[model samples]
Target: SAVISQKPSRDICQRGTSLTIQCQVDSQVTMMFWYRQQPGQSLTLIATANQGSEATYESGFVIDKFPISRPNLTFSTLTVSNMSPEDSSIYLCSVTGTGEWEQYFGPGTRLTVT
Candidate 1:
């Protein structure tokens, strides 16, 4: 099992600004992913962060818009580039559980853009 922590539980930012959220895991995880949950919406996979490689983003997400960095096996960061009010959402860091397809999520960084 892995324990994950995310920075900035909540924040309010102006449009066109950027925010970088950090994710730290207690143990090395085989799979780490970033997700976004908008108001009244289901979670959506933003990207997968694999150590020593560029993050693989899902459809509708580009590296230019959501840059991810995994410096090591237990740590990663996601930066929201060129923010906007439309970007307001909860960014969650999740990791696949040991030997299971289930994922554990962090408390999440809730961002409100205005």
Candidate 2:
């Protein structure tokens, strides 16, 4: 199993600003994903970050709004651009090993845009 941690466990930001959350994995991972969970909603996948390639954003999520970066196999970043109150959600970083089907998630970054 891989251990994952996210920076800025929680934060409060003003509307229209942006926040960048970082995810670090103790071991190299084959797959990394970014997800958002609203106040009363299920987890929604934002994008899949692959090493040395562009991130693939899910439906309703565009690169301009939720940009992702995978510098290598163990680190990635997700930036919420031009955030609004509606963007306030818990952002989680999930990962799976090279041959594993089980996915592990980080503690998550809680963002509250006011």
Candidate 3:
């Protein structure tokens, strides 16, 4: 099993600004994922962060908008390149199948854009 942590539990950002959230794991993990859960919406996969390699983003997400970095097996970061009201959502970092395909999520970084 792996334990994950995310920085800035909540934040209010101005439109056009950006925020980078950090994710850390207690144990080495092969794949770390980033997800977004908007108000009253289901979770959506943003990208898969792999150590020493580029992150693989899912559809509708581009590296330019949601850039990710995984410096090692246990740490990763996701940067929201630009801010907008539409970007106001809960961003979470997750790890899959460390022991169980079920993924575990961070408390989440709630970003509000105004």
Candidate 1 or 3, higher TM-score?
Answer: 1
Q: State, as a TM-score between 0 and 1, how close model 2 is to the true structure.
A: 0.96
Q: Write the per-residue lDDT of candidate 1 for residues 1-114, one digit (tens) a residue.
A: 678899988999988889999999999886789999999999999999989888999999999999999988899999998999999999999999976688998999999999
lDDT of 2 by residue, 57-78 (tens): 9999999999898999999999
**lDDT order of candidates, best first?**
2, 1, 3
If both were scored by TM-score, which would come out higher, candidate 2 or candidate 3?
2
TM, every model? 0.97, 0.96, 0.95
lDDT of model 1 at residue 101? 89
Query: Any runs in candidate 3 off by more than 4 Å, and if so which?
Result: none
Error in Å for residue 104 of model 3: 1.3
**Cand. 1 Cα-lDDT:** 0.93
**Residue 32 lDDT, candidate 1, scale 0-100:** 89
**Residue 54 in model 1: lDDT:** 85
